[model samples]
Target: MHWESRHERAPAVTVLAVGAYTVDFYIFGDRLPSVGETVAATGTASAHGGKAANVAVAAARLGGRARFIGAVGGDQEGAEALATLTRDGVDVSACPRTDPPTARSFICLDSRGQQYIMTWAGAADGLTADVAAAGAALLRPGAVLVLQGEIPVAVSAAAAAAAVPGVTVVLNPSPVEPFTQPRSDPDAARLLARADLVVLNAAECRRLIGERAGSTPSGLSAEAAQLRRQIRTATVVVTVGAQGALVIREGSEMHVPAPEVKVVDTTGAGDGFVGALAAGIAAGMPLAEAVLLACRAAAVSVTRQFCIPSYPRASELSHAPLSPRQC
Candidate 1:
């Protein structure tokens, strides 16, 4: 089937997400306990996590046809992950099952809304090239393909490349360790070149490119510029939590400041931003407008706790506050 026809049959915006699906255990309240130290958590909850799954939920919540492509273990957590994705309106028809147990993350949120997380790759690491190939037909032209660091680098790269000449691949290189150079993996530079849009946090951008001139308050324009110089992709977005986001496209740049909110947890704010951005892009919004929409979505995400559960749907986002057209 032709790519466009597939999208037409679905919805106005279709997103093919390739990455991991993890179950997250969130411990809400103050700081994490020290060794042998006991602390009472104000609340505890479990929800779906993993970069791709979060982004898939973000896209779906924002009124897009979001399809997740990854592997889950045959374990109970995997089943829960699948159920969570389905509940979020994500199409899991392309997801597979394995025997390695599903990926999972343990996240702790402090009173300040900062989070510390540890994750186990589990079945996520087993996502191979063959699996991605099986879902290649789902890459509809003009659709958005959201990728991240949760999957194998080769698999992520192949999915990104395959989207070319078909879907628009938006890569969020999270965790940032997989792309480290002189390392035991494929060349990240080559894979990045194939991405239609690259999204990362301030630290990830600095890791990919060296430190550049810019203070925390002025935003990471200098570092963002350096990354733009190093990357071949047309768009590079550097997400700075609370401070907002920066976008560099075709020699032009735009900064979208984040709206102030009572942050409860920031675990999935970045994913929400990327998902919203992809949704806007898939909906044919200009990069600048898309960045603004994404900024709004992310701002809303921080107001709630956890990852996937915190993401706002399109209707909620429509009512959220947005930054004015000034950086």
Candidate 2:
């Protein structure tokens, strides 16, 4: 079954991201600073960031009609974030306002593209479940609603609950909570139950479905079944860095390997994949084909640096819809 009516080149569909919004402070150095020790930085910069915000920016840049629904502060940082999203062609009208001093993240990037990020939750906490529901109500048929773990689980649940029947819910359970266990977090369970497609890294998937002895650890058939039993998701994709994404569905699994490229920064690569996947879904591509496109886009992202700056636009993907080997 397909999600939407496929066209030669489907028109853009709305991709709404409901989560946190923040500003990022990047400190680039030859190596990460040791505990309580200062290291000389090669360079420094600031930009708009946050899981949901990055996904929104990525979708818009990839030719999707993306919209961001989250809270921001009344400070200049918040204002700048809004302006940047606007410039990126993401709709910010549904975003709520909270106290001054928006959320912030301090990221330390090493020359090898590895990073250590420290975050400060500011006005992002003001984004409530009610606010998320209001934003989710804007979604229509064929729309894609993106959710992340950056916000409260209850808030994500509310957004998922409020999504229209035809809307495709994509959940990225980052920073995995103890929410997929026997005594799982109810709100988290609720959110997952509503997700049509669930995307997470290999580590997150292992954490989600408790690792067992002699297990593949990734989204192998057994682990995928455990995840499916936990949440009735139609498709669950476990991303392995460089190995591409492992797509698991009813009795079938396929590994989509990524094209090797020079690695610059691993930061925001997953966000780029999610954004590209959502855009492909909105454009009516098959799930496997969409995952392939996402893999390609993520490969492009890691060839650059930073978060939102690393996302690739639609034009950069030329011939993104490559035919998939039968899954």
Best by TM-score: 2
On a 0 to 1 TM-score scale, where does candidate 2 land against the true structure? 0.89
lDDT of 2 by residue, 1-327 (tens): 355465343223368898888888888999998889998999998876899999988888877888898899998888888898999989899787887579998889999898998778788878988878988886766778999988888898999999888788999997576355525578887888889999998767767777743466433656766787677788899888898988888888888989999888888899889988988787777788889989998999999877898898777888643221110
Looking at model 2, residue 41 earns an lDDT score of: 92
Candidate 2 C-alpha error for residue 213, in Å: 12
Q: Can you tell me which runs of candidate 2 are displaced by over 4 Å?
A: 4-13, 33-40, 178-184, 212-221, 319-327
Model 1's TM-score against the true structure: 0.88
lDDT of 1 by residue, 134-234 (tens): 57545656678888887778888777666647577788988777775623455466667778788998888877775542446364777677777677677
Model 1 whole-model lDDT (C-alpha atoms): 0.78
**Candidate 2 C-alpha error for residue 171, in Å:** 0.3
Report the Cα lDDT for candidate 2: 0.81
Lowest summed lDDT window (length 10), candidate 1: 318-327
